[model samples]
Every structure is written in C-alpha cells, then in structure tokens.
Target chain A: MKTLVIISHPNILESSSQQFLIKAIPHHFDVTVHHLENEYPDWNINVAKEQKLLSEHDRIIFQFPFYWYSSPALLKHWQDMVYTEDFAFHARGKALRGKEFGLVLSVGINEAEYQAGGREMFSISELTRPFQATAEKLGMTYLKPFSIFQFGYMTDEQRFQLAIHYQQVLTREKDNSLEAKEKWIMEQLTNMDKASLSTDDKIVLENAVESLKNNRHTIDELKLILEQMW
Target chain B: MKTLVIISHPNILESSSQQFLIKAIPHHFDVTVHHLENEYPDWNINVAKEQKLLSEHDRIIFQFPFYWYSSPALLKHWQDMVYTEDFAFHARGKALRGKEFGLVLSVGINEAEYQAGGREMFSISELTRPFQATAEKLGMTYLKPFSIFQFGYMTDEQRFQLAIHYQQVLTREKDNSLEAKEKWIMEQLTNMDKASLSTDDKIVLENAVESLKNNRHTIDELKLILEQMW
Candidate 1:
C-alpha cells in the first residue's frame, strides 16, 4: 500500500528518537514522509496540496512525540486548515473514506506509567480516543497505534530493534477481519510446511499452528454459548 | 475563587460563540481571559510568564473550539513549551498541585453525535481524556468539562440562555467532593428559608432540600452496606 507519514514535532532536527525512526523506514516501500513544521514554517497550510497528498496515499500515519498526552500544535493546526468540511467529511468530499489511519507516538515516560494505578493515570489507547473519533467521522479505518515509550532509556540495540518493528508495522498490510486473519494464519502454516526449514524451526511452527487451532475452537465454543443465550 | 481562562482559538475574532461566552463571564469573580493566539502571534511562548499566570490562578480553564477532536495546535504548543517538567511536574516544582483544571469546549457538531452509537463514535468525556490525564499527572482536580455544541444552530434566545449557563459553569466554585457538595446544598437551603418570603419560591426550595436529604440518606445507606460487606 502507498503510505504517507505526516510527522509533527516542534524540534524534529533535535529529536534523536524521530531521527532514528526516520532512517529505519524501509527503502523498498512507497512511503512519503511529510514533516509539518519543515513544510509550513509559517503555519500556513495549503489545503489543496494536503488534500492531494491524502488522495495519493492508502495509509496515513500521524507520527509525533506525545506532548502533554497528545500531539503537538502543528498537527492540530494542519487538521484545522486542511480538513475542511468540503474536503474531509462532506458527503461529496469523503476523500479519506476507507483509507487506513494510524498514530505513531514516542512517549517520554515508561509504558507502565500510562495505566490506571500509574502516574499518568490512563492508558495510551484511552487517551487517543480523539484520533479514533476523527477516523470514525471521516469513515477511515482506525489502525492500532504504534507506540515507543521511554526512548531516552532505550539502548542502541533496543532502539535498532524498535526501528525495524516500526518499519514492519508501517509497511505490513493488516487484514483486521477475523476470517481474513484466520485464513492468513492458515496460509502461513501451509507455506511454512512447504518451505525447506530446520527440524527445530518446523516443530515450533507446527506447535504454533496447533495452538491457533485450539484458540479457534475455544472462540467458536464461546460464540455458540452466546448465541444460545441470545 | 481566582479563575484563569486560557482561550486558544486561532481565529477568535470571527467566532460569535466564543464572543458571546466571553461576554457572559460573571463580573464578581477575579477572572483573567488570556487569548493565546493574540499573545503569541509568533508562536514564541514566554515560559516564565505562562508559569507565573498558572501559579496565580486557583482554577485554570482551557477554553477552545474543538478542532480535530482536541484543542487547537497553539494550545498543544503552549503546553509543550510552558509545561516543562521542572515547572509543572517535578517533585520540587509542583506548581499546579491541588489546583483545579477544566476544559471549556465549543464543538461544531450536535452533542448527541459524541456518543457510542453516534456518528462521532465516542463521548466527549472519552475524547477529553488527555486533559484529564494531564490534570492527574499534575495532582490537580479534573473538573467535568463544559461543552457547548451546535452553536450555529441556536436561536438568539437559546444563545442567551446558553451564555448564562456558561457564566455559571465558569464562575461557580464547584466542590467536587460528595460531602462538600451535600454540605453546600444544606447551607443554601438554610440561607434560602431565612431570606425568601414568596410561598411558591419557598415551596420549590423546600422540595430541593428534601431531595438532597433523601440523596444523602441513600448514599449513607450504600456506604453502610459496603462497610458491612467488607
């Protein structure tokens, strides 16, 4: 899929985390990285240009450092200027409809801090409801957010691993429906068996397939019980 | 209570809803209306001055028209710049501790659209979780948000009534604690009986007092049940 990452960080040049992630994006994929501050230094967003960019992308990722539990000002400003009713939400202007929308956040604190009993007092998912709501209003599929917490504390090796994970997340095509996901898993198992592999690795793959089959059976049983109750 | 309303609308001069709400602020309270866009036209936030303003207020209100399911970009920028860990969150620099924090939002859509089954697919409370989480981190009281929806659809009379309601919400000293609120209600009833002479008004006040008493009784009964179970 054609992906566009709109990065909104006030001091992107100074941010090591963002720089690291930017370099990690796979060169093979058709991806455009649009830096909001760099593009509009004076805060003047060209609506037509932004809408044109949106039209070209199948997946739109809003990437930012989580500032005060949300994205920085420029992203909000971009939304205010670019997403006018005539371009984003009007019946005739549903340009973003059926496109995938996601957030890529780098949080300063530890991941554990964003929980019920934690200092931040709410999960990242709960705090990001605004983004989800926006996607819902625009008729876009809201993808699960990609979060990297405590970037400052991560070692070089850990940072490299995270960057690779991020690239996979951005480029991978996610089939969210249950049936589609199940079919994909089955195809993966079949491919694993056909491919020449070491005995140990083949055993691991077989165990994983067995576990998935058991999980599917359990889910089906639960569904049957729910249907009976209804 | 001393109240500081930080209004962050990029184009406040053109918004009638914001102008009306501004005019309705009660004259009795010590209230400062800080227009962020006008103050920081260059987007250069004076951190010390902003911190000083926050320190002086007992209640800090972030007032804005909801843009992209959140506050305007300038507001987020202000937060990113002004709310440094050394000033807002550090153990030794807990400037916002025990203070009240609230959001005053003017959403373009109807209020009903912000529910689970509605087009918006999330409640206002859910969307505003970031602000609530910020308050929690700062050890500040997170007041229930004051939202005005569909401002463009309201008639002159409706607007006037809403303005009055807005004034009450902004100026009112809300004791969020159940015990404190109950105590305040009882005191109001006592004061009403002593000052009022009209029989109809007196009857209305009496009914309110009776309802409050019943509510208190029910709460006490529930507490007793919980204690017994424990």
Candidate 2:
C-alpha cells in the first residue's frame, strides 16, 4: 500500500529528532513525504493537490513533534482547508473511506510524565483521542500511534539508534488481517525481551504482535515486557 | 478577578452564534477579549504578549467552534506559542499556576453523535482530554467545558434567547471559594432548567455561573432582572 507521510514541524531543519526520523524512513519504501510548513509557507494550501494526494495513498501518516499535546498550526490548517466537504466528508465518503491514519510523534517530556498521577496527567493514548475520533468519522483505520519521548535528553548514540529504529517501524508492512496482527503483537509482548529492542524495534514487534493467543499471555507478563522496553 | 476571553474562530464575523455572543458581552465588564484571528492575521503569534495576558487573568476562557473534535488552528497555535516553558511551567511553579482554564465550544455535529456507542465514538469530554492535560500540566484548574452541538439548525428565536443567556454565563464573577461556586452552579442549572439550554448556553453557564452565589450578577442578567422591577 502506498503510504503518505505528512511531516509538520515549524522548523524541520532545526529538529534533530524529526529530521533523523525523516532520513531513517526506508529509501526503498513506497512512501511519499510532504512537509506542510515548507510546502505552504504562506499558509495558502493547495487544496486540490492535497486531496489528490490523499486519494492516492492507502495509509496516511502525520509526523510531528508534539507541541502543546497536538500538532503544529499548519497541519491543523491543512485539515481545516484541504479536508473540504466533498473530499473528506459529505456528498460522499468517496475519498478517505477505508484509508488508514497514523501518528508519529516526538515529545520533549519523559514517558513517565504522561500518566494518571504523572506531571502531564494523562497517558499518550488519552491525549490522542481527537485523532482517533477524526479517523472514526472519516471511516479510516486509526492505527496505533508511534511516540518517541524525551527527545531533548537523548544522547547522540540513542538518537542515531532511534532514527534507524523509526525507519524500520515506518517501513514495516502492516498485517491488514486484524487476527494475524493481534496474534503477532501478543507473542512479541509475551515472549520477546523488550529491553533489547529500540523504539522502532518495539513497533515492528507490535505490528506483528496481534496474532498471539490470549491464553498464552497474562497482564503481568505484558507489563513486564513494556517496563523493560521503557 | 480579572478574566480573559480568547476567541479563536477562524472568522467570527461570519458566525452568527459567536457574533451574537460577542455583542452581548458587556462593554464594561472586567474582562479583556482577545480575538485570535484578528491578532494573528498572518498566523504568526505574539507569544510574549499572549503570555502577559494569560498572566494577568485569574481565569482564562478559550471560546471557539469545535473542528475535528478540537479547537481551530489558531487556538492550537496560541497554546503552543503562549504556553511556553519558564512562563507556563518552568520555574518550580509558574504564571499559569492556580489559574482557571475553561473551554466554550460549539460543535457542528449533534449531541447524540458524541456518545460512546454513537456515530462519533467518543463523548465530548473524552475528546477534549488533550486540553485538560494541558491545563493540568500548567497547574491550572480545568473547569468542565461548555459545548453547543448541532449549531447549523438553531432558529433565530432560539439564538436570540441564547444570546441573553450566553452573556450571563461569560461575565459571571468568580468568588474566592470553590465550594460556593459549585453549589451556585447546581442551583443555576436547576433554575435555568439546563436541559432546555443549547450547547453554547451550557458552556457559558458552566464558565460564568459561579458569580451568582456572590450576588455579583453579570450586566446582562442584572438588566433583565431589573427590567422586571421597572
């Protein structure tokens, strides 16, 4: 499936994490990357072109640094403008129906900061409900979001490794069969030692994880794996 | 207490609901109204100025139309730019600490569509988790949001009546006591028959309804009640 990555950072060139992730996306992958800030510096989006691109891609990825728990202004503006009535909704679910939506986010805050009693007061999954709702409305599949936390504190070695891992996750083929994917994710979380894997490695494992049988795993087992991964 | 109203519609001039509400806001209220679109015509925010306004206000109200389950692009931009570190969350405690944050919103979709098992797949409260998280991080009290749904179908008569009610809610004075405000809200909701209120009206009521307990009624509410005395 053709994947479209809409990169939205106010200053992509200055972004170490975002830039690294962009370069790590597999060169051989059938993916197109569009930078919103660069493409529409004036904020006058080419609505027709954007709609055409959406029509062409089976999967859509929004790549950005999490600012104020959401995306940059241009992406919001793009949604407001490009996702016009006929194209995104109304008159027909003709364009976006059956498509998949993905979010690739990087945050300066630590992972522990996002929790029930944590400093941020909500989990990352909780914070992304709007996107999930949007995907539901458009009849698109809301894939699990990929988040890279503590970007500001990462060492050079960690950044490089994360970049490599991110590319792997973005390029990894999704098992469209829900049963197969579910089984795959369960096995990875149950048997595999997550500490050995990078963020991207965890994603690859997760993408294949859906096929694992529920009886084979327990909540504690999965939690231990996730703890090690973090 | 000083109040700040951040109006974030892309074009409030064209909006009958917002315009009516804006007009109804008393000119002499102890409030500063910031029209985001007017301030950031080029979409380039003055972060310093915004931070100053936020610092000056005891309560901050974000008023907007709900787009894609959240505020418009300008609101996102304001949150990202204005609520920066050192000002909002950096110094042990910050300017936003102890302040109150509330949302006043209108959604195009119907209320029934926002139920868990409904077409929208999530309740409005759930959908606004990101904003809640933001307020939590900034050490602000996140008041329950006010929302108006199915805005496209409101008749002129309904809107006119809503305008008077909207003014009461927006300009209500906040007392020093939280318990008193909470109790007052329950009374107002009972007296006003909340079920009869539109989404827009509910939001204003939820935000400004506190002052009633202190006998600090808004200009609009005072006028209506005093008119009966005449």
Supply candidate 1's per-residue lDDT for A26.
Answer: 51
RMSD of 1: 9.1
Cα TM-score of candidate 2: 0.74
How far is B191's C-alpha from truth in model 2 (Å)? 20
In terms of lDDT, the best-performing candidate is: 1
Highest-TM-score candidate: 1
Task: Please give the TM-score that candidate 1 achieves against the real structure.
Answer: 0.76
RMSD of 2: 11.6
The candidate 1 chain A region of ten consecutive residues with least summed lDDT is A185-194
Enumerate residue pairs that collide in model 1: none
Q: Write the per-residue lDDT of candidate 2 for residues A2-118, one digit (tens) a residue.
A: 889999998889987776777776555678999998898888999999999999998899998888888887798899888777888876645898988889999888899888788
What is the C-alpha local distance difference test score of each model?
0.85, 0.79
